[model samples]
Target: MQLQTPHLTLVLISLLSLNCGSWAQSAFTIDSVKLTLLPGNSVESGTKVTLRCDVKVSHSFPQLSHTFTFMKYNTIIYSKNSSQAMVERSFTPARRSNSGSYQCRVTIHSKEKSSNTETLTVRGLQTPLLRVESNVVNEGEKVTATCSVPEETGPLQFSFYRNQQMFMILTSNENSTNTSVEFQESGESDLHCTYRHMEFPDSSNSSNIERVLIQPVTIIPSIKVQPGLEVVEGDRVRISCDVLGHSKNGYEVFLTDRETLLMSSPSSFTHSFEVNASSSGRYVCKVETGKTEKISTAELFVAELLSRPVLSMSPQQVFQGQMLTLSCRTLNINQERITKADVKFELYKDQHPLKEGHTFNFTASQSSNGNYTCRATAKNITKESKQLIINAKVPVSPPVIRAVGQVIVGKPFQLLCESELGTLPISYTLLRYQRPFYTLTVSGPQRSAVFNISYINHADEIHSFTCQAQGGAYSRFSQALNTPVIEPVSKPELSLGFPRGQTFTEGTDVSLYCSVQQGTVPVTFFWYRVGSSRPLFTSRSSVTRGEHVIRSITRDHRGKYYCGAYNDAGQTQNSEPVTVGVNLAGWKKAVIAVICILILVLIVAILVLFLKKARTPRKRKRAVELSVKPARPKSSDPMRMSLTLDIEDNTAVNNTPGVMGRNVWSDHVSDSESDDPGREEECEKLRYTEIQPQQPNNPEEVALVVEECVIVNSELQDGTQEDPDHQTTDSVEYVQLNHCNQNPE
Candidate 1:
């Protein structure tokens, strides 16, 4: 029963959940949306049309509002929010501008859907009427052309055509437009007009053609050239222009050679001119009356009278200080009219007149080089020959060769070859060891040529480079260029004065030698310690080897050592590092030895005196005791003390000035008098000696003496001994001996 109840509960809950899900999913959904064009997708202009938007939607709710939108060319034209799904707009008369892509969109809540785009095309335009003001017109006379579209308005572009070719276009807001055009020739032309709506470019139509007739001018001009149209240069020629028909309006006539007006007169029609080669062309005669003009043409040929003088030069190649001759020659001429003597000749250099003759002669110097031409004139006609260029060659002087910059072995460098005086183009050859290795031709005002030498194999070997320049028939050689090449310093070898595996002692002089296998002179040497960037010593030497000496070396000088060498070649080469160790100086060792001996001797003397006292101590009831007072607390103070021995009461007391009435063994006495029961009182047998304090000349000696005494006392206190008294006695004796040694005076 329990299981069945649980299953039934699950089933009921699932059913309810599914129902809620279905309602949520179907809250708002668009089933379909469509845009339709009424009266079909394509229709004639002025026909009634409609754009409709239809949408179908499904919703869970009983009532849901939706928006309907209609768009043309992606721009919304109509929109409405309503419960209904269908919406529409109508155009009473469709216009060409109403043709385009249309779309509809429907929105419900947040859900929206758009319909596929549909196109509407309204085609048809009114045909324009073409008209002309006159059916017949004279050539060059303007006639009016009118294009009208009575049914259409609003800025229209109208195009007018003549003989099927459009010649003019105009825009007007009126239904009719007109323009004036002229025909250049007398011929019948077919004229038409076409108009397009500015708002809807596709709305265009053409009108029927109109025919117009053109008439020729009444007065036609005739041109006649006297002496048949052909004549030699420098000959007189006359041209006449006359109207063929008589005119009461008194027409004017013009005579022209090509486009240049020679004569224009209403009473005179003849023109006389001396013809030259430049005057040969078509001659035109024109007549004008009222708005009409007529023209006739006649071609004239003017033969050259002296056949263009030709300028020539003797010995095509001219050199400085040599004679040069220039002559003018002519192939043909009208000898019957003009003789050789009748024709005058003149020469010009660089546009300046030089001489007048058939031939000219001058010395070819630097000043003579210029552009030359000759002129021949006869019968008021002049002709010039083609330009002749003259450049007198100057023999090349000795060329100079030099290095551009510092030369280094195994590197590319440039060498320049130049001449002080020479005319380009000059050929240059570079020689190495008297053998040509490179050649080049230089021109265009560059006086020098540069040659790049890739590399030199040997730095020490002598190499000579020379350059030769040739401008004319002969070549000249430059002086040889010789310069030493710089060599980079080789890796240096570092050596210490001490033998291998031997340590250097402090306060000894040591030398560090650095040498290179091969390098340039004036080499610079540097000494450095390992793990350091700066050099300890630096020296410049003319040889490859260098040395650095350290006087009175100290432990501070201990570390790794290395050397570096560099020359003009700019590279510093370093040697492998060598380790150096420094030991203590010999004088310090000797001082330590003397201190040990003094301590040993004092211990032996104390034992001997104790043995002597024990041998006779029982007979004499009093015991002798010696006590030494230590110096001041300063570690550097000399161990100066006074010692005295007492033979009564077995007690020793120091009577020194600063330590009077004080027991020298005060610490030991305090221990003996302590309350500890384990200790037993014994007879005092240790002895100490008193030595007087004395001032020393050297403070270092006093410090050494103090140090020795301190060492002896510490050793005695720390010694493992069966008898504490014996150790105490030894320390006292050591102090006494050290004081005595310092104050022997």
Candidate 2:
């Protein structure tokens, strides 16, 4: 315990020294050290000013010594020991070099520290520095002015004052020290800027004055050429300039190639000029608006024009299936010189493009026979040559001559000539016996011709015919052919070989012959009815004779007949109508003859009977006729006599009375004498009564009557006949069955 006190004291002292060392390394500082210029922070050059430095430290230590040092822009000018911690100095006029940043230094215990920096700006009004972007700018270009005050706290508003008037205003951002303003420089203007603080609006200072001299701005015109940069020679080219945003009336546009002027116009934007060999070069367009000028340049090339093309054919006339060669040539002019390598050729057939080459070759045919032309082209120029016609004529073969109809006398015929596989527009001629008969030209490829012979006569038999074809420059002929024989037909005469006069009996043979005097052989005969148009019979004969025969004739064969003869040459007239008559059958004729003979016999018998009757006596005829006459009753009587025929009495005349007996009957014979007393007339009417002795006075007659009565009574007593009803009138008995004959003498 006794030894620990000294060791503790040593340890405490060592720790105090270590704490003081650490504090001395980091705690040494200069406080409240200031360097100021009397009156203000800023001043003009050559001004009287006072410079002062005040220094202070954070801790006062007995061992800590203080010294104050004043410096001007990092160069020490005064040093002093400031027991009072203050020092002062003075300068009558400050130099421009002394107007930079200044400082005050405080040193303690051999360690020195500096104060915050302070700046002093000593400015002189002698020609403030002015920077103009460009003295000669465009009229609308911006001209900026920057006014600065050194080392001043400011949110400055800067204004451009032109000729003492505010031309523009610009406000800087808060706490910003930038004092620049921009103004459009137009015409002549004296410009300057004044920058003032936000707190002191009226307290401001101007920068150096500047004169912004502006000239008229000329816009660069856009220029271009029409029809592109490549142009054909002798072609018109248009060069145009668009002078936009400029006055249109006062501008003059000039177009040129290199230094040579091509065209110039006032107040115009476009100009047209012909391009030639001399026009191919760099072209320039200059636009002058008042005193200002702008220009643009371009390069142009002018191609030469092509000359007319020439076409040539190796052979003018070519045959079919043969090679044909055609050549085309043209002159290509370039820069006033002709060159063939620059030109191209085109061949045309019938105005249509055939090929594109200098020479063309192909097998020729009929379709290739047309006009051919050539065309040449160089750059943009074209020219056509004269047309050349090609003839691909094919040789014509022998013509085929054909006869269309039969070659006979008095008949028309047609001969045709055809040439196939030949070229078009061929001419043909038909010759008879080497003489030209007809000539014709065919327009199309069908090469055919026809000739008509109006009438073929006997003379044609000795003639020969031929056909010829001509195409272009070639001709061909066919072999001769002999003409055909021709004979005419003559009228026919029809004859019938019959014993009867043109008449034939049924079931008999008959023949008709038709003969022509001057007709061809192998003639055909036609038999027709007289009124009919169709033929009833047809016969072919080797000679000029035609015959028709009928083995058995019939009624149908009886008609008017005519015959016609026709040969290959022509037809003859029909023969006259021959009336052919057909007789009836044999049995039919015999029956008609028997009937006629029987009629004659009957007529003769009738005549004989008439003669016998005529030869009889008239009295006997009257007695026979009166025997049948009836006795009519008198008018006062209503009774009539009736007679009945006795068929059994063959010996008596049993003939009934005729109409004449009835007409003159006894009833119609009236006794007119009884009705009229004027005259006495004997009544012819008689009645049947018994024949008595009429007059007793005549006894001889009575005696004869009695004798007759005795004979009658004796005949009656035989009883061969019965007595009729008898009547007794007055005192006499009458027999009604008997009549007295008027002629009973």
Candidate 3:
């Protein structure tokens, strides 16, 4: 027996252990199970997988052991220990090495029971990363698809879209990448690729929305259109719209007048409406799209045709060749309401046109006196303005020149110039030849020129005066003339005399005089001295003789002088001056006395010599008588003639009155012969009777001979007293007689 001694011990121990468990019970349960996956739940690779082993309850000291295990597809993947409230568990993502399912298993143990088993399911994950570089494809290009996996590299599929609609798909390897299908040209499409993963999810999304736009064969529609200004009547207007594209069909165009459509067409659109003044409204354009129900619109404004333009008048009436202007205006319109072509205008006189084209301007003249009109061409139309009438004025004529007096001096004469024909506002200018005299201004009432002056004193004055007239637009002037009038210079009075030419000895004063003959005004007088180039002194004229006196004359003052007088008019000629020479003291008187005395003394000496000569003649006569005594027996002495001699004058010798013939000499009667005239003759005869009648050889004998005698003493009748200054002069004249012995006895 191997140990028979323990049979009773083993049976007793087993019953005890079983008996204790009947009194104590166990408390435990399956807590929970949580599942996770890496590309394992319909997702991609490179993702984490989480496994949770959660317990709801646990008995203290009675819970012995807990076991948790993770599995994939009934295969163990991972596991962990758990007690009282269990936590979670995790697993890594699987590549090609982990393509399977996943689950969880729990084992529990307590004091009286054996361990228990609980099972949960798990799944593995698998993923593949794939990409395609180019999805859009032009024509005739090779297609390719590239797929990449961490465990194995392979091929993929690519597709394309046309106009956002799918079209084609393709598959390729890394050597030849995959892309969209090939065609003849490019177009708009979308492209994507397909990828398969053994470790993760089966497919993936695309890179981005791939768009490929193609050059299309279709056309595009037009844009909007508008107008700058309003539409006008009769305008060949372009009802235009803004459009773009090469498609030129299926378009409808029309022009509108507010709500009403004036013209419409599919082919020919805008109306070139030749409008009149009555045609005008709001305008616009309407169009339709090509082969579509769409509409394109453009609005425009057609303004009312510019009111018939009119040209007007200011002073419509004027003379021919007068200046004027005509103004043209567009009527019945607001400011700037129309465009350039809306308002048409032109000017005309009668039917003749002014400007070649449209404008609001015109010119007028004297010849422009007719019905005037304006031609207005607005839009595509024309009109003629209302007619305006004009009247004209004529001009006046020029007048003749006239005078009021014969003379135009001393404020008494007047002259007038007038005009019968000239324009209004005529102006006149009075002139003496080219020299201006006076001026006159006139409009209508005052149109005359008057000249007035008096007192014509000039004797031979002459002048030719003129007047001229001017008015509107008279480029030249009209003129006329009158007679002429010279004045002479006045005469001056004069006097010529000296104050006292001889007051004038050495140191006294002397003057020259000047007086006017008939003049009354006080006259200025001047005295001129000779030897001087200018006047030595000056004086003035008065009622009395004007004297110019100079004091204390020297020797140099002995020169000529003259006096002159002057008034307001001018000066008179000078009068001659008298000179007075000055000498030293008493010398002049002494010289005169001495000259007279010497002259008297010479006369006395001359008388004495006359007496001596008288005596010699007597002696000669006595001697002659004595010599003749012897010859005449009866010779008696009687009164005989005696001789007189004037020694001062030898020419007085023949001047005795009785010498030529015996007159008063007689013989004395008492002395016998003196009483008888015959006896006196006989005595004289006998006295001369001869002694020796020969030439006397001795002068003593000749001396005793008597010659001739002079008698000066005579008596006047009535016996007036004889002047003592007169005395008897006895002079003698003796000659040698020849042979006196024969003398008459």
Candidate 4:
């Protein structure tokens, strides 16, 4: 029973697995979906049509349901869920709105498929009929027009045309439409109407043409002038507006001049007024009735009573103290009405009455500069002429030329040319060397003209500028301008007052010279040291060269020096540097000299003891002695010294000014023989000597050792001074001294 149970369980599990595999693989798919039009794609209106959607399915299941959707122009028109493969939608009477692209969609198990689109065009529209209220109508009068399409659907548009030209369009949901239209043209016009369904605009038909006779209303008004078209001033003129032909009742009349209403009255159409220059224009007569207006025009000319009085001056350009005659006259007059004598003339100055006559004479002055006019009167008619402006000019005096500021060389400056007495608009000329270089016209309230001088090379060149003023016919010249020009100082040369290669002693004066090649006078010179910004000395000189003396120069002045020169030309030129060397102080020089003398004295004392030891006998023990003595002052020679060594007595002597001497003794025992045993015993001696000055009164003289000598003295124990037989000549040495004098200045 266990074995059978296992077999049964296995079989059941295998069956369940097979069922699941089959279910997963059985997916419903739509094979094809097609849309077909029953009565073909193109059909006439009122014909029955049908859209059929056929869907073919391929599925593992025998029964599968599909959702069918019928679409027109992408919009779902009919939808249904059914097990059938084919679905149909019918349009009993196909209209223009039903014509569009038709498609079908089949959906099953969440999978959808669309068919190819097919266009169903229904082409047909009922022709409309056009009718007018009246066959004949007056222009500008409204008439009723009716367009009817009896079998058409709703939402239709009707267009009305006049002589083949569309004039009005109306949209309505009904089969008929009517509107009132006004015709501007007066003639026979063929009117028609076309109707189109809103959904199918391309399907439409024009109605039959209806002839409408438009009559034009002609009621032209006539304009009449009572005083004729051409009338003189001060004459009464009457303008009348009347209709010449038949006009409708309740008509209004208007009399106007240049579109300005002069009179508007239905009972009376006449306007009367005095004619003047302003009234001379085109007059219009207008008549209005209902929606029609008619007009007639006539021109009127108003002649002047007398010509306007003209005020004239004898001379156009009037100056002060000159004869200026002003005359007022009428050029023309109405000879038929009044002669020239009958016309009276008056003159005015600045709107104030001046005189009453045909002519007025006066001399033009500053007071005469004003606006002038004249008026003429004849037969109660008065007219004034245009204003005349008169300006009495004053002759310009001589203009003076002056510098605007201090003139500098190689810099821009201005020169003003002004006249004290002159009228406006005076022409001033800037002359250079008697020739005009620039001319400026002074206008408005400005009385001076400025000339810019770019640069000047020399001081004398400024005298060439002159100015001249001219007003009206009078002109004058000014004197030549004399302005000083300042030149820039050139690079200065700095030098020392002392000679070259000379040392600058302390407490001496140092002079720094600064000179320029070319510069103006009154140049300031500044002296400066190296590495210093402030000047050590400053001086102003009127010449080309300036000197800055540093009083009592010290070692502090021992450095590089430079100088600078400045002038009115606004530039300072610097000089090249010069080096100064200063000597030591007087007390320092004396201290150095004393130290050197002490060292020389010590050397001389040591040399004397050496000589004493050399002169001793070999068999005898000899004693060497060096003697010291206080230095005695030599007359007029303080820095002199003397030292001597006598080998025969074994003695040493020393002499030095302002120095204490001491004795130095030594014992020496020797068993060796001398190198030159046969030499003379008194042949050589050691001596330090001083040569006396040739000029003892000269403080600048000093002794100096020029040559050196070496001496040797040999003596026996018996104190005998003799030469050996082997030495034929004496051993003598010579020392020479030289004296030099130096000035301390």
Cα lDDT of candidate 4 equals: 0.74
Per residue, candidate 2 scores C-alpha lDDT tens digits across 305-415 of 765678998777667877889999864466454467767789999999999998999988877889999988765566789999998868777787777756666667788
User: Which prediction has the highest TM-score against the true structure?
Assistant: 1
Model 1: lDDT of residue 576: 91
Query: Stretches of candidate 3 above 4 Å error?
Result: 1-507, 515-562, 565-594, 614-745
Extract clashing residue pairs from model 2: 632-667
Q: lDDT of each structure?
A: 0.76, 0.65, 0.47, 0.74
| Candidate 2 lDDT trough over 10 residues, lowest sum | 656-665
| Residue pairs of candidate 4 with colliding backbone atoms | 628-661, 628-662, 629-661, 631-656, 684-712
Per-residue CA lDDT of model 4 for 653-733, tens digit only, reads 222121122112122212221123332121122222333323323232111011101111122211112323212222222
What would the TM-scores of all predictions be?
A: 0.64, 0.38, 0.21, 0.56
Q: Please say which candidate is ahead in lDDT: 1 or 4.
A: 1
Where does candidate 4 have its weakest 10-residue lDDT segment?
Answer: 704-713
Q: For model 3, how does the per-residue alpha-carbon lDDT over 1-745 read when each residue is reduced to its tens digit?
A: 5596599789988899887674333544444444444324443344454545444444445554566666656667566666544545554442323445555556665422111223222332223333434555443343343433443233444344444455655554431233434433446544444343323444444333444433332322332222233445544454443334535766666656667777666644334444444444445554544323223544445455566666766555445456556667766653354565556677776787766444433344456557778876643456677786754444445555666544433335666767776555666766665666777767767667676544444422223556676664442334545454211112322222333445345666654455555333456665666666676565554443466666766666775565565553343444445554455325655886787888888877787577658756643443333221112222343323422111222225423222222212222134443557776566555444332234445564344332322111112111113322111221112222332221121
The candidate scoring highest on lDDT is 1
Q: Could you tell me how far off, in angstroms, the CA of residue 22 lies in candidate 1 after the best superposition?
A: 41
Task: Arrange candidates by TM-score, descending.
Answer: 1, 4, 2, 3
